[model samples]
Target: MSKVRKVTDKILEAVSIFILGIMTVLVVYQVVTRYVFNSPSSWSEAVVTYGFIWLAMFCGAYVFGKRDHMAMTFILDKFKGKAKVAVEMINEFLILLFAVGVLLVGGYFGALKQMTQADSILPISMGVIYIAIPAAGICMLIYFICNEWDLVQRLKGMKEKEKEEE
Candidate 1:
């Protein structure tokens, strides 16, 4: 599980970096073309917009996998032992449900609906941009499964330690 998580982390990191780099270059090009050449590059602008969407979605999933997403942990900080593990598990389950119901299912339908629509500047279907939603959802699901497994292992270890202490 850890190996799988590590590979996924590297892959997502690489993709996010690549997208950022491309977007940066495109933005620079857009600025140069507009200011230096006195003409704006419409295609670059469209590409950068789509790239930013992909970057944001992928990076969000990556952050979730790293367990680095923002949260108000004041309530969580009060839990102890098995209760803490249980609460964490429940929280993860809720997030997993949201990823499935909203990001996966809803995103799929949204992308499908956009498939028939073409972007004004880009030569591709609008679905191409929306597809990132479901892709990130899939990444989130994988990370959730890995997280749940880790929590179960931790809970079992805690139980074993308690028995030893007794």
Candidate 2:
């Protein structure tokens, strides 16, 4: 189980990096070709745009896995007892709910796009581009669940400590 967690995180990290790399390469290549070569491939813009979309999704999931989402921790820090725990659980539940929505709606819509091909430069199925949305959502959901479980364990341990002290 521990090994699987490490592998899953590393996979997410690597995918984010891969998407970033592709985005950089595509953007740089497009700029160089358009400016330096005096001619641009018509496909460059679409490819770069799609690459950016994928990068954004992958990086979003990766950051979520890291528990680095921007939040005002100060107020949360003051929380205690059931209120603190309940609030925290609600926060996590909302995020989980969003992820589930993404997985359901995004996945279904993405499948629909897969059947429709883009009419523009790339001329590929829209599915290729939109699939990332649902995929990232699922990834975020998995990470969030793992995070909640870890937190529960810690909270249980704390409770144990409190009882022992009493």
Candidate 3:
């Protein structure tokens, strides 16, 4: 599982970096063409917009996998021992439900609905941009499962330790 996570992390990181790099270059090109050549490239602007969307989705998933997403942890901090682990498990379960129901299922269908709509400047369907939603949802699901497994293991260990102390 760790090996798989490591590979996923690396892939997401690389892809995010690549997208950012391309977006940066495209933005610069757009500015140069507008100011220097006196003609703005509509295609570059469209590409940059789509690239930003993809970059944001991928980066969000990467943050989820790293457990780095912002949260109000004050309530969570009040929990202790196995109770905390249980609460954490419940939290992860809720996240799993959201990822599956909202992101995976809903996003997939949404993308399908957009398949017939084409972008004004780009020579591609809007579905291509919507795909990032489901893709990131899949990544989130995987990370949620991994987190739940770890929480369960921690709960079991805590129980064993309590028995030993008694």
Candidate with top lDDT is 1
RMSD of each: 0.7, 2.2, 1.1
Cα lDDT of model 2 overall?
0.77
TM-score of each: 0.98, 0.86, 0.95
- Worst 10-residue lDDT window, candidate 1: 66-75
Clashing pairs in 1: none
> Clashing residue pairs, candidate 2?
none
For 1-166, candidate 2 gives per-residue lDDT tens digits of: 3465577689877876787777678788888899999888668778778878877877777777777889877877899865676677778888888887866476758668685777467778888778888888877877877777767876888889889999
In candidate 1, what are the lDDT values of residues 1-166, reduced to their tens digit? Answer: 9988998899999999999999999999999999999999999999998999999999999999999999888989999999999999999999999999999999999999999999999899999899999999999999999999999999999999999999
lDDT by residue for model 3 over 8-112, one digit each (tens)? Answer: 899999999999999999999999999999999999999999999999988988998888999788988999998888888888888888888998999899999
For all candidates, the clash counts are: 0, 0, 0
Error of 2 at 18 (Å): 1.6
Q: What is the lDDT of candidate 3?
A: 0.90
For model 3, what is the alpha-carbon lDDT of residue 10?
94
Q: Pick the candidate with the highest TM-score.
A: 1
Local distance difference test values of all predictions, in order:
0.95, 0.77, 0.90
List candidate 3 segments past 4 Å from native.
none
Clashes of 3: 0
Residue 46 displacement in candidate 2 (angstroms): 1.6
